[model samples]
Target: MLPTNSCSSPTMSSPELKKVTVSLPKRLDRSSERWHHYLTIDLIWYVLGYTLFHPWTSWILVLCLRAQYTKYHAPEMKIAMAWAMLMSAIGIFHIFSERLAFGSPREVDLSDEVIVITGGVDGLGGLLAETYGMRNANVAVLDTKRVDDEEAEEKGVLYYQCDVSDAKQVEAVAAEIVEDLGPPTILINNAGIAHTKSILDTTAEEVEQTFRTNTLSHFTTLRIFLPYMLREGRGTIVTVSSVLGHLGAANLSAYSASKAALLALHHSLRAELAQNPAAQEIKTILVTPGQMSTKMFVGVTTPSNFLAPVISPAEIAKSLIRMIEKGDSGELAVPLYAQYIQILGALPVGMQAIIRRWSGVDTAIAKAGLVKKDTSEKQ
Candidate 1:
């Protein structure tokens, strides 16, 4: 038997509920930047891929011709059939190409995996960390920046203050992560810094630091955390480089060089893993994004917005998360131009020069006043 309060029915006052306002950070609105923002080449290509260029859509034209009682040998009917066959063949070739290049994807269970991300406090890494954290996965971030207790709790992630460039620091954090969460099964080497300075103006110390942070950090983290994955018999490694690695730009020598080294390192890592029976399940992903909309390149402008619009960190983060969840290993080059940048190098020298001049890749930093000055004083 439950006893009721006798005074409750005398007079009951309802408490007023106040509305709590939540403020979110302001994001850059690229849509309102220019009149042509809505008409990017990427948007045009995307539309074509889904409609005119799609195999099913191409076949639909043939069906429409048949429905109109057009003769099979008619020019329009023949053209439509041929186009449909071509589109279908291209689609089948793409499927085979992906299978040949990346092989079959492995099974991924997020609940059973521990992910370690470098530079996870901000930018692309931050977006990825928060995404995985939201899904309640075991995530550990190693960065020089420290996240406060309240923020860490709200984000559902563990932030370790450690410079991933240092091998000893990485090893220390690896031990702590193993104790706190578990052995790391996913490694995202995305920590990078850039100095927009010409090679002649850049100092040796600056170059060394750039390599240590951007390039050597991958090696350090891999050396420390990879053994755990090997012992565990499965893992995934993601290397975040830049498309500028393939196209060397003026006033970005150190950064481009560091990223280029990563391209080579990725292939080497994959080759080594392939040779090991225990590492067959250890997949690798390479990301080469072009001019992300992050603080690192705040003032740098894209030469051609129609062809090479600046990619958002959120966009890249989503693609990366998709690949990881699918357990697929492959290369990701965003922006339509990034995928074809390699072909630029193989073009005729005169054509390359003309394209470079028109694209302004070599002059963008200087024009934007982003080039760093040498500290040395003229005597």
Candidate 2:
């Protein structure tokens, strides 16, 4: 671990310094890329949001009509004015609804907060940890993966080698974190593992491992670390789930079930926190992202690039950081589809099945031949 006093040490170079020296990975080749890659529903929606849906943009349209000497009673002018008012009303209502649901956001000072991230050695967790470290936040990472002392020091993060799935290990690590950094006020539970196997094909051991890592780890961390937040009377707990959790796939039975459990857990955490008077300042953020370009889903392909474009870890991280800093409890669902997935469950059973089949939700893994085989097959 780097010395606690290393933050002020001039000898310790910033992690960004390594970025200058290290060669970055090459961008994906254009020849192999498809036209669909450049065009997605998300891109179109984003453009529409800024141009068509934006209140200011709507007003601009009205202004254009007026500039053209259109009378207020003219059909085009009336439509434009009505549209602008509707957009403005929607924007105002959205802000008011958010405030009503989450209450006021608490002030977040990065310097005063100690951030703890599980699975911080790699992927989204690593990205968040490094970002905070660069900002000189007291950052601690608990993961089974170990980072070398020099690299950890250079990154300005304390790496704790702990298997977060194990309650004992998490408890021990929590103690160390409390001692190293002050009691962690920001808890990011992003550690998860997946076994691409059918229910029958998945062994009990593998299923147990998946649950331990994905679901139980949240309980372990919360049980151990939540009291610290309670004592401090303020904290932000981030739960990273998956869109597949709501729409279970054929070959991802164990993985999906575990993530599904997290959805319930997140809501339970929020409800319980609401009951506690002292927990009013404790914010809970739930992140349900669609297929991300992380190593966990490296070979996995989305069924529809237009509908469910693969999200970047960086995008999710940015949203999480923003929510955490704003100290607001909210759900961060990416790829538009993820946000509205619950609507699928509300549809007719026959329609739901048809939609699922059309979306190729159950067949993606099997078609890709990425299904995990029995241990006997490997042997």
Candidate 3:
């Protein structure tokens, strides 16, 4: 038994927490011989953001020039001043744009919030649920995977074995969650399944099943859980989508299409929520993460590690938790490319084809031998 005065019993002391760990999930692929294997475009962008693009940091160049006794009219000083002003403008624009698009962030207290996550048995969902559960927060996880009572007690989370695809089942589980925990103040619709097959090869049943879990589950949860949020006067809804949704892949047609529907659904949800005065405090977050190092993409390989690096599920979870706790309403697109994928649509067809060919989005699944039998779920 844990000590009565033990402060770290759940989080730090629970060293044997099998599914979720305190540290971030280690990346699977570290086999590259090159020293720059970990040096991704996203990493470079992050460093540049703080050093060069940051308003205050950019102005440091002006300070250095002044200390060197350089005149203001000198070329180096003028260039420095111009760069500083540009950075300042960019910083100001970012703040104003964020405020205008999402309005002000709401207040969120995790302890007071009853958090519910669909497909929280493993993967990104599991990471989210377990993190909050460890903190002694009211966390309920819904998934097809069953967790024994002992395991549930150990993790400090209530596990409900329910098929998220079924509307009736979700409704039934919702009632149980309301009874066990308080009304769910945070809803994470993170359940998804992928059937890696071409359009012609994929069966009708497979297509429906894919949509049922990947897309339709969001509608089911929102219909049931959103009302409670409205009644509670504050809540946060998170929708987990894929970067592949914008760029349809060859073998992953059903999966990509299903995720694509969520993009539209999220926008529609935002519009509806905006019309409701009761939902003024309801914050929405849309996460479109790139290929993550999860069970779903075990065999899949990135075309370029530098440009399209495999992201860890814990990394994605960390970003989501921060946004939800901060009560911000916005989209979280991981990696540098995922955020700007929409630009591909504006490009000329030939140029777009060339880019896609180079990216190898279509051939990755085929190369990985992801046939019809190799279906995987993202929890």
lDDT scores for all predictions?
0.91, 0.90, 0.91
Candidate 2 clash figure, as a count: 0
Model 1, residue 367: what's the lDDT?
A: 87
**Candidate 1 at 175: error in angstroms?**
0.9
lDDT preference between candidates 2 and 3, better one: 3
Worst 10 residues of 1 by lDDT: 24-33
* Every model's TM-score: 0.89, 0.89, 0.88
lDDT of 3 by residue, 1-379 (tens): 7757736645455557467656544655556567788899999999999998899998998999999999999999999999999999989999999988888899988779999999999899999988988999999999999999998999899999999999999999999999988899999999999888877777788899999999999999999999999999999999999998899999899999999999999999999999999999999999999989899978888889999999999888888999999999999999789999999999999999999999989998888887665345422
Clashes of each: 0, 0, 0
Runs of candidate 1 with Cα error greater than 4 angstroms are: 1-31, 69-71, 377-379
Q: Candidate 2, which ten residues in sequence have the lowest lDDT sum? A: 14-23
User: Candidate 3: lDDT over CA atoms?
Assistant: 0.91
lDDT tens string, model 1, 1-379?
8997666443577665799997665664344566777578878998999999999999999999999999999999999999999999999999899888777788889999999999999999999999999999999999999899999999999999999888898888899999999999999999999889988889888899899999999999989889999999989999999998998899999999999999999999999998898997888999999988899888778877888898899989988999999999998888888888999989999999999899888998898788989978422
